[model samples]
Target: MNTAAYFAQIYREPDPFQYRQRWYEARKRALTLACLPRQRYRNAWELGCSNGVLSAALAERCDALLGTDLSAAALADAASSTAAFANVRFEQAHHPQDWPTGQFDLIVVSEVGYYLSAPDLSEMATRLRTSLADDGLLLACHWVHPFAEALSSAAEVHEALAGGLVEAFTYRDADLVMQGWGVSPTSVAACEGLR
Candidate 1:
């Protein structure tokens, strides 16, 4: 099955990944948010936003946020989930191919990279670097264990996405791996003039 169909099938369950209920999911989201180097972003885009659980949280920190997913069902759920957020918008997009035209100060790739083939991931990395604002940041998080549907390992996905970007930080556990990348190599303390 293709990625869209696979996701569409699973999304029929509304909260297929239990992103809203699982403690692991909540903790991961919190960690992702806390790891961000800045308190606010002018513009942000979340690739494969799923049901907008994380998108809504991100909306709180961004002036404008765009969430994209390949599944219409997922987008519908995302819109409903983030209905109160005027700064958030949802769209249907197949990454690296249906990419948006503008740059974003924050681009999030979460739980979606492993679905792409190697070539697609490479193209995505290149596009991500170019689409990022000069001082922008890129964050990617994914499951570490092998899964039947995943086309690539989490390591491969992160490596491809890390191309042309400086490592910011990484968090890993048995279940997941999360990393942040950006143009500058500075730490949060350095950015805050504490270093």
Candidate 2:
């Protein structure tokens, strides 16, 4: 399937993934937020920020956030959903080929990685390493179940991206797998000087 066309068709409805209505999505977002070792970040990037529901939540913890999507329709939805946040912006990007210029203190990859080919994912992992700041963190979340469009499994995606980084945290359920890596991995309590 044409990736852009597929997502464009999916975005025919405003909430294609039911991000706003689904309890699972909401809880995943909450877990993603809670898993961050730092309370706030200077700069953040969210890949595949379809409709920007998570971007809106991430904006609260970031001084500046860039949300990128491959589909124009998805970017439009993301822009509208995140309009209230002055700190958040949306862009059209096809990753592992298209990348932002600056480094980010926080990078989020959710539900998008499985769509990339293994070679592309490998390249993306390299780019992610370069784009991440010295004290940055990378978080990824994906549905565990296989789907027609997925070129790779969640485990494969995570393995490809997590290479050379220190793992910070992880969460797994029957439906999803979420993991984070950092330049210098530290626990939340350690970040808060509790340990």
**For residues 1-195, could you state the per-residue lDDT of candidate 1 as single tens digits?**
488788878988989999999999999999999989999999999999999999999999999999999999989989988999999998899987898989999999999898989999899989999999988999999999998998989999999988878998999998999998988784778778997
Please provide TM-scores, in order, for all candidate models, with all chains considered together: 0.97, 0.97
What is the C-alpha local distance difference test score of candidate 1? 0.92
Q: Quote model 1's TM-score.
A: 0.97
Model 1 misplacement above 4 A? none
Q: Which run of 10 residues does model 2 get worst, by summed lDDT? A: 184-193
Cα lDDT, all candidates: 0.92, 0.92
Residue-pair clashes per candidate, as listed?
0, 0
lDDT tens digits by residue: candidate 2, 45-141: 9999998999999999999999999988888888888888999988899988899999999999999899998899999999999999989999999
lDDT of 1 at 23: 97
Model 2, global lDDT: 0.92
Clash pairs of candidate 2? none
All-Cα superposition RMSD per candidate: 1.0, 1.0
